[model samples]
Target: MLEQGDQIGFLIVSGTFLTAMMGTFIVAMVVLHRQRQVQNRQKIDNLKSEYEKTLLNIENEIQQETLTQVGRELHDNIGQLLSLAKLNLNSAKPEKQAEGKEFINQIIKEVRALSKTLNLDWVEEISMDDFIRQQLHRIESTGYCQTLFDSDQSFNELSKDSKLVMIRVIQECLNNAIKHASPDQIQIKIYKEDSLRKIDIIDNGRGFDTSIQSRGSGMTNLKKRMETIGGSILLSSVPGKGTHITLSLAF
Candidate 1:
């Protein structure tokens, strides 16, 4: 019933309509892909910002804690020993003059030794386990969270700088939890696995949402600090379930 000219015209219109629809679909897909890419880039930028902020907090804490701890050692340990030696020398009996002279010599040697290592962290290596335990005990006495340290193999092989950075990172994290998270407990674990060093920090605190950007810059600064030292930090947390941070680096 249709004329040839009319049928031909209808076919052309149908083809044109279909082509436009396909073009629209392709264009829409390209726009969507671009939007997704932009969103992803923004997300990564935000994460970097957060990491930098946390690192700053860590650096500040390190300076403060290092100064405080060293001051303490210089005061409590070395100073007290020097005082005792002086007292003993003053009380030496006349009959024991030779022995007193020998004792005074020993005290001088000890005072010299302690003075040499007091402010200098380098020069020699120390047992990391013993060091960590001592640091934690010192922190715990400040009426902060109950701190615990556990390590399978004593991490005594790390360089002085590495140990200092790692300790500073841990120190910053603990301070954040106490000052911000308001956690009830804090735990530190250090271990060597397959030639790598791992430090796990767990806290039972008010908890936070990692999805939301941290209002306090402590988390961000800590992450950046680790990265600068050839280390990586993973922060995973859940609301009401506390927060956990795992740090890894080559020792």
Candidate 2:
């Protein structure tokens, strides 16, 4: 019903409208894509910031604990040793003077060992299993409770930051058991399952209800710390039975 010239004009108008719509769509898609990229970058930066902050906190706490132990050792162990050495050195006998020299040498060695723990380098120098063994030994030395350690001999290669966080968490667990659980025996086991390295801290003690949240934030903080290191913590306990905590990290 229309002339050819009019029909050609109609077609040109439709084509122009379609092209404009497509251009608008393409511009919108590009804008949206750039916005998503920016958002993702921000999210990644936030996560990195949070991780560094956590590591700093863990380092500070571990150093504080180390300082406390150093103070105790200097006062109780080294101080007493020095007094004994002085008494021996003051003696008229040659044997007593020799014993005094040996004590002085032993003190030097101990001081050197304690000095190593003053820095964060020890975290990298020591493996988690070795640290656990040392802690158990210290606890057993106290004669407060018995401790047992079992391992599958699986080697875990953890980063220094992760190792530091894990060490602090394990220390907190052991301290809590000694302070609150009043257990007669504490046991630690390290093993590997699938792609995960696991450490279990078990104690036959007065267990509490895990369902009811504690007034203190200790357990909650432990869980958060593990999460930060791409690890998880599972706790199970019965009032009369015992408490068991499993810490798992992916290799």
Alpha-carbon RMSD of each model: 8.9, 1.8
Worst 10 residues of 2 by lDDT: 152-161
Task: List model 2 lDDT by residue over 1-251, tens digit each.
Answer: 46988999999999999999999999999999999999999998988898888888989888888899999999999999999999999999999999999999999998999999899998898888898999999999999999999988563477888888899999999999999899999999999899998999999999988888889989888988998889999999999778999999888
TM-score to true structure, per model: 0.54, 0.92
Top model by TM-score, which number?
2
Give one clash count per candidate, in the order shown.
11, 0
Model 2: residue 153 alpha-carbon error in angstroms: 3.4
RMSD in angstroms between candidate 1 and the native structure over all alpha carbons: 8.9
lDDT at residue 113 of model 2 (Cα atoms): 91
Off by over 4 Å in 2: 1-3
lDDT of 1: 0.72
Q: Model 1 TM-score?
A: 0.54
Worst 10 residues of 1 by lDDT: 115-124
